[model samples]
Structures are given as structure tokens and as C-alpha cells.
Target chain A: MGFEMFAVFPGCTLEKYSSELKEPLIKILKYLGIEWIDLGGRCCGMPLLLSGDSESFREVIRSNTDYLRNVVVITSCAGCFRVFREYYSGFMVKHLSQFILDLGFSSFPHKVDLRAVYHDPCELIRCRVAEEPRELLRRIPGLSLSEFKLNRESSTCCGGGGLVKAIFPSLAVEVAYEKILRELPQDVDAIVSSCPFCYLNFKDAASIYSLNIKVYDIIHILGMALGVL
Target chain B: MFDNVFQTYKLRLYEAMDNSFIRAALRRAVDSFRINRDKALKRYSDVEDKRLRLIEVKKHVLSNLESYVKQTMESIESNNSYAYYAKSINDALKIIDEVIGSGKMIVKSKSITSEELNLNYNLKLKGNIVYETDLGELIIQLLDSKPMHILSPAIHVPKEKVAELFSKISGENLPPDIPKLTMFARSFLRDKFFKADIGISGANAIVANTGSIVLIENEGNARYVSNTPPKYVVIAGLEKILPTLIDATILVEVVSRYASYYMPSFVSIISGPSKTGDIEKTQVLGVHGPREVHIILLDNGRSEVARDPLFSQALYCIRCGACLYECPIYQLVAGNFGYTYFGGVGAIWTAFIDRELHYASLIAFTCTLCGRCKVKCPMNIDTPEMILKLRESIHSIKLIPEPIRQIIENVKKYGSPYGLTNRFL
Candidate 1:
């Protein structure tokens, strides 16, 4: 398969707390014979758009689209995938899950026995980029997936959207906590989601609520299974 | 605009979130509505097709709004009913005052259009004895609370609260039995229905071609309000017009499916007045219902909304609370999210009507832009899109909050909202 080409957009979260998600991502891509280029430090302009700064949002969108106009840009963040696909139409954008699902990994470096419920990020669901993450999660051996009663398009928010975390952090956390109490599977070992924002919110809930469940980005779980984390 | 309202919004949001009774009621109501809506839609082979047809009809009428308004007025006049156009809230109230003309006993059915004008408050301030007839609306009126939902105005109130409220009103310590409480309200309102000189109602759809107004409800109070009084008045937004009775019927079906997931128990189609041709084939206006019918078409910034290409889709809303059932934020906040109208649709509508953008901003900002409202809407009104547009418009006027401005600054300076320097090499 001639899958040796794509520009990778590792969004801001991957540069910070989710940096661990990258090494395994790279290893898995390499194992699948995919060649990727780092698109460098740039915001996808979602925060600006959500926060009522249209001029800067425009500038960011213009610059990002101008840079990636010719190449297929693969994003590790679901928000980046949404902004690029929906707003900046100059380039073809894909979530790394979609790219990986297309490339097809032969084996995970190690098997992980994980019983997880997938938390669909609003951006992923709205952009219809939801199933790729679930399919990728299913690729892991000995991992069983259960669903929240409200899943896919109707999934409860992680309370990170529309800059709520920046504006009303407590309210955001409260919403996240409620989602956990109401929707989360009682017997699940972990909650896995694809969006970094959702991952952060869920992580906050897990800590503040002192729940004994691990919250992982699908990439983090894949990284553990690939023995690269 | 954004800052002043944010504090109150936070407090109200906290209160709403803390109230377990309201939360449980909202949860159950939304779930039941969703399930009922789904099951109801299963009867049709193509709900989307019907929805698209309705959207087309609405768009056509909105595009030709001026001519349609004129036509509707002419039809009402020819049918021996009076029609007047009110350009603003004060203008609508003035028309209502003129029509009622010092009438003391007044009864009103559930009308969100009336709520937008604050008609009841204005009338009460003017010393008219006005009673709300619809059960949910009457409950909210008794509690002196704003409506919490479009269809179910008192959805946030628990049975115990209603029982206590009724006990105080009727001087009887009523149990929380729903039927008994309903019986109390029915008897309480029955006298007002007959004793009133004027009945006020809202039109769901004004059929321009036939000069008929359609009112759909489950409570049957609209029928009493429109029929029992000597004088009847309909206060409706100008956008509530359809080309013909057939279109109105289609709208009734669409609204029923979306509002509560079943056909409403009552539909009142009043053409002009209570007319009788039974005597000698010579028509007389008053027989059983109101002798004089007056329909007031209130503009209230609808012309501007119609002129807007992006936002005019908002007027296509049939007041079906389907989006409310689908909305996560509205599920939490109930009607506290808006000033008059609630949820995303209310935010856009209030932005157009309310000058204070403070209340509008607070209402609009809480939306997460999840696009679920659009998915749930039969007309597919892009509520989240309209809200973001409202934000952008208010931003252009420099009304954005300080925190949001700082967040934008942080994103600009540090490529992330967290304001951290790049840690990845």
C-alpha cells in the first residue's frame, strides 16, 4: 500500500499533556509503513472562533489553510479535524484514527485487556468522524467495548466545548461530573475518547470525583498496547 | 452586555443545577418526549420529505412576507373580522387596548407571542382582570414564574409544589393527585371562561388565503378562550402565516409530532367570527362564539429577521420543543437560558427583539454549538449557527466579555487557550 505520505497536525494538547500520545502514534504509523511530516506549532483557530474573535480566527484559518492547501493534513486532535474539514476547505483533513483505520495496523505490539466505554466528543460526532476511533479501539485484542445509553450523536458533553472551561471552569467540571454519574458504565475499567478537550475534562472528573477509573485518549490506549508509551 | 448578565446567569444556572426536583422532572419529560416523538415519526415513511416541503412553504411565504401580510389582512376584512399590523411591542399592546376598550374580564390561552409583548403584565398594570386559562401557563402565572418550556410552561415545577400552590389558591389542602389538582383548576377556570367579556388567544397558523386561524393544544383551553367570549382577539407574530388551510394542516401535523409526539387533543379553526347561516340563509356574525374577531399581526423585528438570509430560517420554527428535548444545556438550565423565548431558538428570537443584548448574550453564550438542536429540528433551523452569528455580531460592537477577550488573546499569544509555551519539539 502506498500509504507513505501525509502532513501531521499535532495540536496544542499533544504538545503539552498529551505529548505521550505522539511517540506511539509515530511508531504505529511507521509500523504501518506511513510517512508523516510535522506541520509545526499552529492553532486550528477553534478557541478564537468560540470566544468571539473572528478576525484572529480568520487569520489563523487563512494561514493554516494556505500552508496545508496542497497536502492531505492528518490531525491528532478531533477539534483540529473538525475546524480543518468544516471551516478551512482548502485542504483535505483527516483525524489520525481515520488515517490509521485506512492504513490498517497488522498487530498491536502488546495486547491490552481493557473494558472501556467510548466518550464521543461533540466535534467528532458533529463532523461524523466518530466511528473511526471506535473501530481503532476494537482493533486492540482482549478489549471489550460497552456503550453509554446516549452514545454517538446523542452523547453527553464532556463540558469542554464553546470555551466553557476557560469561561466557567467550575460549571464545566460540574457538567462533566454529572455526565460521569449519570451515563458512565458502572463496571467499565476505563473511559476512552478521541478529543483532547474531552480527554482533559474526563480526566478532571476522574480526579475530582475520585473515581477508580482511568481516562485515556484512544491514542494513549493504543500507545500502551503498542508498547511505545 | 456579556459581563452584566454573566453573574446572574451563573447564579441562576447554579440554582437550576442544584434543584434536584426540577432536574428529575426535566429528565423524565425530555426522555418521554423523545421516545414519543420517535415512535410517532415511525408512522410516516418520510418525515424528512414532509419537513422539507414545510420548509419550502415557509421560505416562500417569508420571502414574500409583505404581500402575504397584505393578503392576510384583506382576507380577514372580507371575512367580516378586523385585522391590524403592529410594528412594535407597544404598538401591539395599543391595538389590544383599542380592541378590548376598557373590558374588565379577560381570559387568555397560552400565547408565547403575548409573553414577548408582556401583554398580561401590561394589562394587569392597567387594572384589567386577566386570567391565564392553559394549565401550565396558569400554574406559572399563579407562581409568578417565567415559562420554563415552550410547550410545557411549568415543566420545572414538581407535583408537590403544584399541590401546595393549588391548596393555597382553592383553600383546600389538596393531595398531589394530578387528576384532583386538574379538576380544581378546571372548576376555577370554568367561571372565567363564561364570565369574561373578551378572550385572548395566540394563532398557531394564520391561513392567509381563507382568513382562518388555527390553534392546536392538548388542554382545550384555547377553544374556550376563542369561543366563549363576546369578543375574541388573536395576538400572533406576522410569521405565523401559511398560504392555505392545507399548509396549516401540514404545519399542525409537523408541530404535533415535534412538540409532544402525538396529535394534540384539540384543534380550533376559527375563520372569522361565530357566524350562523342557519336562520333564513341570511348570515349573522354571533351565534355561539365571539361576535367580533380581531387579529393583530405583530412585526416586532420580524421584518429585519426576514431580511437576513442567515437568520430568517429562525421564523420557520413551529414552536415545536423538539430541539429542547435534544439540547443538553437546555436540559440542564430549563427556561432559565433565555429572557422570553427559551433554548437556542429563543436566544436568536430574543436577540432580534430585546435591545439589551445583555440578556441575549448570557442566553446565547451558554450554548455548546453541538449541532444536536439542528439534528432534532424538523425544519432544521440552525440554532447553533445563528447563536455563533449572534456572538460575532455582538463582538463587532465590542460587547464581548473580558474573559472571552482574554482567552482569545491567550490563544493568539500562545497557540493554546492554556497560555503555555510550546513544550513539544
Candidate 2:
């Protein structure tokens, strides 16, 4: 993928988090022998669209859709999945984990028996992308997963999104605290997440707040199984 | 405050607050708010529409607040109620202090504005007997804690812990039952309401046409707080003002149904102090609903908000707090969403209004940059854009952790932050 991958950012991945997962993501894809063409998309426009700026949102999406043809769009953010699956229905969308499992499961030459719980992103479940990640995770041998009590239809939001973090930090933290308090297992060694957004946000939650909890990206874990290191 | 703001960000706040006693107190208080709010929302079918209409009304009100507040103040005076328009939090706080002498008993109902000013602690510091009458607020008060949720102040507290708090605070053997907890708070607050000299509340909507301050709540306390006291004061955010009574009426329909509530048991519309055209058309203001009503119209940076183009758009928020429940990061870490403000949008506002207030640059950085917060926001505040601006500001200052900084620098040089080479595996 070229710089066009930057468009998924709207403005975020562009400026603040531009470097996140770039190397790990690129290395994994290359190891999996997957070809990811940029297709020259604009900013995912999720941010602009979410703000009720439909005009800017439409303009950005129109530009993105124009460049795509018969290629599966892979991204690690559940937010991007929501926009691609529903907003731009023309392109096939999958979180990077699913793409890796589909194209590179047999390419794996190592084994991983890591036990962890998966933190579900609200969008993946709320917007109905729930089962795909689990199906993909199952394809990897010796991957033990735990279930959240409030999973799928009953899943609660992570509270990291919206302007809550910006506008009302106290209330937003309260919500995140609730989810982690309820969903995270008491004895789990690590938490795995498919969405990069959820992955990083939860890392902050676990490392800074809980301190004892551990977290990892699904792609990062899968890289071990594929002997891509 | 600036010296210590970043300290809170770097250290784990929740673990610090996670003493066994404090944890128990939070668990007890949060459960009842959830149950009551759930029951309220269950009674309504068109909650989504009501939420949308409410969002639209808030946007319109903020857009036209200058004219609406003038009209509202005129109507309030025409009806014998007084409005003290103040341009800042201090201005409003001073107006309240000047009117209500210190050390008097003050009864407060549910209002996020009260929390925003840290009003209870401020009042208590001045030797006033302050009683928070709202059930959730009462529980929090007993614990000497700040509110955890806007609509549900004690949402972080589960029920069993509330029972434990009740057993200790009230000297009663209350079990962990939710109903018992409600009645327990009610039993204690009922006496406070009648004997209290002052009543303080927050308005859901201040109708300019009718000069009415609308109090919508599932509990009956807001009614008693407004109606029973001799002196009633409303400390309302400027965004609460709406154009017409009919517009507000549509909003009452929405607010009652979808405060993430079923239908509020009580929707109090107090146009003015309880007055009567007794004996020959002469008006008398004394009766019920307070002999005197004072509406303190607070700016607290709202006017500056109304003036700006880039950030002013978010001033349209109606404080529904629904967006928190729909968030991803908010769901984790329970109450630690990340300090004074948690979650995505709060971080942006914290950064914009005063970045010093929320030093967690992590709160802004941790957002997966997902637009979900905007979708969940009733006003649809563009959180992603705001977060980008916040992160840009934070990164520019190099407040980023050293490891993350090295990552970004690597990405700058090698086109990948992980410091990986171009070779496959």
C-alpha cells in the first residue's frame, strides 16, 4: 500500500497516529504474500461524516470509490469496516486479521498456544461484523480465547470514540472503566483485539489504568504463528 | 492545577481510587441508575426520533441563543421570576453566593452543572450544610465522591456496595436490593427537602416563550427541590435555552422518553414562582414552587463557543450522555475513561477549552481515531476531527512517550514506525 492508506485516517492517522502499526502491518502483509494496492482513496472521511458534515463526507467517499475496482480493502480499524461495509458498499471490506487468516493460514510454519481474551470493538458487533474475527482466529491452531459476558448483541461500547474523550473526559473514562471492569476476565494473561484502534486504546487502559493486564494486536500475534519475525 | 494535571494522566487514577471501601461505594451507587434509566427507556418506542429531535433542537438553540436568552429573560420577569445573566462560571457562582448566604442549608437535585463547578465541595468548604437530594447524587455525596455519569451520577457504583454504604451512612441494615436502596435515599432526603432553606437544580430546557425552566426526572426529588423550598435557584448552562414553548414541548416529549430513560415519572414545568391572581386580579407570588425563583444564566465559555466557527459547533450538545454508553474506550477501564474527562470527544473539548484540564494526552491519543464517538453523540460532534487536532497539539509539544516518539520518528525516516526492513520475513 502506498500513501493512499493515509486516507483511512480522515485526519487522525494522517497527523497524530500516522506511524502506528505501519511497519508491523506492512511486514505482516508482505510475509503473507498478500498484495495491497493503494487504489488512491481519500481520507476515510469517517471523522468528517460523523460530525454531520455530510457534504464533505460525500465528497471524500466519492473520490475514494472512484479509484477502486474488484479489490478487497483490508484495514484493522472496526471504524473503517463500518464505513466500508455500509457507507461504501461497492468494495469488499475485511479487518486485516481476516485477510491474513484467509490468504496465509497455511503459510504459517510456527505454533502459538497463547491464552488471551478478545476485547470486541462496539462497531464490529453493533454494526454486525461480529463473527468474522472469531472465525478467522479459529483458523490458527492452539489459540485459546475467552468470552466476554456482555458480548455480541449485549456488548457495551468501549467509550473511546465520540467526542466524549475530548469534551467530557471524566464521563468517557467512567464508561471505559465499566467495560473493562465487566468484560475483562480476572485471570486472563493478555487481551487480543482485531481493530488497531481498539488494540491501542485498550493498551492504554490496561497499562496505565489496570497496569497488570496485558494486550496485543491480532496481527502481531499471528505474525508469530506465521514465523514472520 | 497545571502542575498536577499531567501527574494524574501519567499515574493510574482508578487504581489510586480503588481502595476497598471506595470500590464498594461505587458498585452500590451505579446499579440503581442503570435500572431506573432502563425502565424509563423501555416505555418509549421512538427513542431514536426523540433523540434526533432533541439533538436538532439543541443545535438550533445554541445557534440562536443570543436572541432566545433575551426573550427568555423578558418572559421570566414578565411572569415575576428573576434571571441573573452572568458571562462566566465565577459570575454565576457569585450571583448564587450573593443571594444565598453561606452556612445555610442547601438542597441540590441532579445537575451536571453543579458537578462542573464542584459546587458541593465549594459550598461545604464555606461551612454550608449541603444535601444532594437526588438519589444517585445522595449516594455519591455520602461517599464524598464526584459524579461518575452525567445522567446517572452513580453509574460506576454497583448495587451491593450502595447497600453497604447505606448500612454505614444511614445506620440501617439495608441489603443490596435496588428498591431498598431507592427508598433508603428517599427516607433520608425527604426530611432534608422540607427543612432545607434553599433549593438548587439544573434545567433540561429553559423555554424562552413561557419563561419556564423544565425539570424532567424519573425521581420525584427535582419536583420537591423546586416546589417545596422558599428560595429556588436554577444554575443552567446557556445551551439549555430553547426558542418557543411549543419547541420545548416537543423537547419535553423527547427528553422524557429518551434521556436513555423510559418515560420520566415527573416532568415539572415551573413557569414562575407559584403565584395567584387572588382577590381582584392582583398577583401574589407566594404559594408553592418557591416564593422566589432565580435563574442564573451562566456563560462559562459558552458565548465564546457561540462565537467560534470551528469549535462552536459542539456547543449544540444537550448533555444527554448517551454517547458515553455507545463508546468503545469508555466501556473499558470502567470509570478511568482517563481522568476529569474520559473517552474521545471529552478529550477534544478538554484540549480545546483548556488542554491543561485534561493532561492525559493519552485520552486523545488512545482513541482508535474511530468516528464511532461522533455517531453516538446526539449532536454528532465531529470527535475524530477534534481528536486529530488534539493529538496534533500533543505530538507537537512532544508530550508523547519516548517509545511512541521513536516509533513516529522511525516511520518518518523509513516509512514504517516499527523499524522493520523491506525484506519479507
Candidate 3:
């Protein structure tokens, strides 16, 4: 792969809630021979936007825009990716799936036999990043990808967007449960997501509701496939 | 104050969640609507083009709202029909009261505009009997419950509940079977249609050039509601006006397709009261349909919404209710997520039309801002964008929920919503 420098924006949820994802993400990038820098941890202002505090959101935007002006930023967090794409300008923003797809890897280092359904995060799907994540999952030789009944633009939310989990926690879990029951086939080995919020919500809901299904972030699956775990 | 509102709203949402009947009904309805809408849109390849064109048509009408309102009124007058402009909900109620006196029997098709006016309650207070002719609407009326969905008003009620409700009403044990329940409602409401002194219906689109009120429905109820009575009245928002009949036709098509109907069974274009020149070239009115036709063009905050750049797109909605089916929050809480309207688009409508900014304050936060509603809307109204904007207004008033306010404060203090530094670093 050609040398390209990228900044990895580990948004708040990934930094605080699902830090397990960070190592695998960095290892995958390193194994792909890409030069990357960590942008450190910061709030993406999505919570502020959700709370209707545009003034604070603008302040955060001003500081972050100035800081990330010079680099091609990549993030695994859907909410941060959305805030960057919609609220910020003059900087290139790419979801990690899009970034990985752009790098054009030919094959996975190892074949891992597993069947999983891909959950499209609302923000990334709306940003038209639906196909890229699926494309990345497809590249793994032995991993079988099943689709949610409502995928792509019509994908159902996992009930974690717009600060729902923070404010209306039970309602969010119920919505996540509905998505699982209605959209997911029972036969899949696991459910995978590209967004940290989605990953956390699905994991929490599965455990709380005592659902037998396992949940994994797409990076973790990729890490396993690439022998980087 | 914010806490009280948030608590009350949360209580309602929790209640909705606990109702397994609503959950089951919503899940089934949402699934059916998606499948039916997809199938309906697939039959017409030009649906997208028509939607884009309808957006332009709505934009044009909204820009020249006063002109269209004027032209439509004039055309209706020339067609021997009465036209009344109501600047507010009270004005609309007063007009209806004057036209429909005490002790009159009124049959109505489903009209969300009337819901905005609280028309049925006010009409009943004046010693008038009002009947909702649409089956779902009748079910809601009997239960004295607010509509849960725009098109499917009683969508939250399962068939078994309907059987129980109908069985009580009929003094006979009715089966949970759909056809039996529908037949019971039909036989019960059939009398009102024949004996009604007045018929009231809502317009899907009002034509400015032709002075026509276009009604789209699957149940034959609206046809009877408008034609069976001696007096007919149309209660519609001023935003429903289109420049021409052709524009209205396109809107009707778009609404039906997105409303999950291949084609609505009945499309009524009422130009005026029933008239005929069959008697030796002399024009005479009231042949078969209603003799007196009244068009109540309701402003009711729509003009204000149209004037505001950010909220003007909300008026482009045709009330197809596709967004409600697609909304995750709505799928869970149903109509509890909104004030009067329901779902994301309903939040915008509630804020502006209902003029209850405080209620909107509570309703706005329930949305996940998923943008699925916009994707499903035929008008492509960016509801999520409007929601954030509504939230900004709500935030200024300090009505944002405490937890959300905490998230904002935490972001400011800790550079993270969780109020913690990067432990991973």
C-alpha cells in the first residue's frame, strides 16, 4: 500500500466506554503499513448538538477544526464521523471502513470461520458509508456476512443515536432489542457493528435482556481475520 | 420546571413501553407498511421524479401562499361554494359552529386538521353529534384516545382489543377476526352517513386554479362523508394548496405511494356543491350530493411556519405517516413521542402549529436523529435537521432534560460527555 498519513479520532465513547476497540484498530492500521497519528480523546460535540446547545457545539467545532485542519481524519465512531461531515468543513473526514476500503487490501492474513450480521449505524448509513463496511467484511476469506433485513439507507437504528442511551436508557435498550428481534436472523453466530455506540448498546442490551447472541465490533472481527488480535 | 416536564414525558414513554399490545401492533404495522410501501413504489418507476417535482410544487405554493389562498377562495365562490379563511383554531371553530348549529348530526372522514382544532370535542359540547366514519378513526373515537399514527390512527390497538371494544358497543360477542370487526363498524356507522345533516372531510391537496379539494382514501367512507349529507365542509391547512389541478394530482400520487397504497381506492375531486344544467339549460344545485359546500382554509400557524426559512419545509409534508413507521423512537413509544402529530415531523408540527413550545421541548429529545424519517419522506423534509434546530430553541428556554444538560456540562468541563479524561491514553 502507498504511504498515507491519517489521524485516528477515537471519539468519547470508544475512549471511555469501549477502550478494548482501540488497540485492535491501531494494530490493523499498522499491519496495513499505514502511517497514523492519534488525535487523542475529545467529545465530538454530538451530545451537545443532541442537547440543542449549538453555541457550545460551535465552540467545540472551532477548536477541533483548527486542530484537525491539516490531516485526513479517520474515525471508527459514527457519531463523530457525522458531526465532522455535517458540522465541520475544510477537512477531509472518513469513517474507518471507508478509509480501510480506500487502502485496497487484497486479502486477509488468516481465514476465520464465523457467520455474523452487520449492523449499519444510523449516522454512517446516512452518510452513505453502508457499502464500504460490508465490502470490508466481505474481504475476509472465511467470514460469512449476513445482512439485516433492513440494511443500507433503510437500516434500523440500534437505539443509541442522538444521546438516547444517555437520556432515555431503558427506551434505548428496548429499541435495540426490537431491532435485534425483528431484523436479525437467529442463526447468525454474532452481530457486528462499526460504531462504538452501537457496539456498546448491543452488548449491553444483549447482556441485560439475556439474549444468547454475541456482539462484536467490526474492528475486532477484522483484527481476528488479519491475525492482529 | 424542566424536570417536571421531562418526568411526565418519561412516564408516558414508560407506560407505552410496558403495553405489550401497543408494541406488538406497532411492530406488525411498521413491518407491513415498509413492505407495502416498497412494493407500491416499485410499480411506479417515476415515483422519485414525481416526488422531486412535488417538492418544487410545494415550494412554489408556499412562496405565493397568499395568492393561492386568494385564487382558491375566488374560484370556489365562482363554483357556487362558500369559502372561509380562518386565521386561528378559534376562528375555525367559530366558523364551524355558525355553519353547523346545535343538535345537528355530522359525519366526518379522518382529518388531522380537525384534531388540531379539537373540533369533535367542541362540536359535542354544542349539543351536536359527531361521528368518525373512517374505521380506524371510529375505533379511536370509541376508545376516546388520541391517534397514534397519522394514517393509521388506531395503529397501536390490536385486533383482539378491537373485538372487545366492538363487542361492548354492539351488545353481542364479536370475534377478533378483522372482517367481523370491520363489518360491525360499517353497519354501526352506515346509519350516520345517511342521516347526517353535514359531512366534513379534509383535503389531501387543494387546487388553486380549479378550486378543487382532492381527497385520497382507501375506505369508501370519505366519498360518503362528502356526498351523503345536505351540507359538506372541508377543513384543511393553507399549506395544502397547490397551484394547479395537475400539481394536486402529482401530490395525490406521491402521498398514496408513500402512504403504502398502490393506489387509493377512491380519489374524490370536489369542485363545488352538486349542480346541474339538465333542467332546460338552467343551472340548479343539490342534485344528489350536498347542496351547500364550505371550504375552511385554516391558517392556524401555518403562515408563520411558511415564513420561517428553517421550518417552511415542514409544511411540505402531505401527512403520509411513513416517517412514523421508520422512526425508532416512534416504533417504541408510538404517539407518546409527539404532542398532537407524532414522531419527528410531528415534533416540528407540534412546535409551530400547536404553538406549544414547552410540549415540543419534551417531545424533541425522544428522537434519535436517525434521519430515517427524512429518507422515507416523499417530500424529503429534513426532520432531523429541524429537530436539532427545535432543540436549540428548547435549550434557550432551559427546557432540556437534566441528563442531557448534564452531558453538555460534562463535555464542557471534562472534554468528554462521560466527564472523564482518556484513561486509554
lDDT of 3 by residue, B393-419 (tens): 989888888898888888888888888
Better by DockQ, candidate 3 or 1? 3
DockQ-best of 1 and 2? 1
Residue B230, candidate 1: Cα error in Å is: 0.8
Ranking by DockQ: 3, 1, 2
Q: Cα deviation of A48 in candidate 2 (Å)? A: 18
Give all candidates' CA lDDT scores: 0.83, 0.65, 0.88
Of 2 and 3, the candidate ahead on lDDT is: 3
Give the CA lDDT, 0 to 100, for residue A193 in model 3. 93
Computed on C-alphas against the true complex, the DockQ of each candidate is 0.53, 0.13, 0.67
- Shift of residue A172 alpha carbon in model 2, Å: 15
- Which pairs clash in the backbone of model 3? none
Which ten residues in a row are the worst by lDDT in model 1 chain B? B416-425
For candidate 1, the TM-score of chain A alone versus the native chain A is: 0.92
| CA error at residue B112 for candidate 3, angstroms | 0.2
Measured with C-alpha atoms, the lDDT of residue B127 in candidate 1 is 77
- Which regions of candidate 1 fall more than 4 Å away from where they truly are? A1-5, A18-35, B423-425
User: Per-residue lDDT of A1-229 in model 3, one digit per residue for the tens?
Assistant: 4444578897887777554877778888888887777876777788888889999999989988867876789898888998899889987888888887887876888897888899989888888888888888999988899998778887889998888788789998888898888888767989999998898889888999999898988889888988998
Minimum summed lDDT over a 10-residue window in model 2 chain B is located at B416-425
Model 2: CA > 4 A from native? A1-229, B1-4, B14-43, B125-127, B158-181, B253-259, B332-335, B338-342, B348-362, B366-372, B394-425
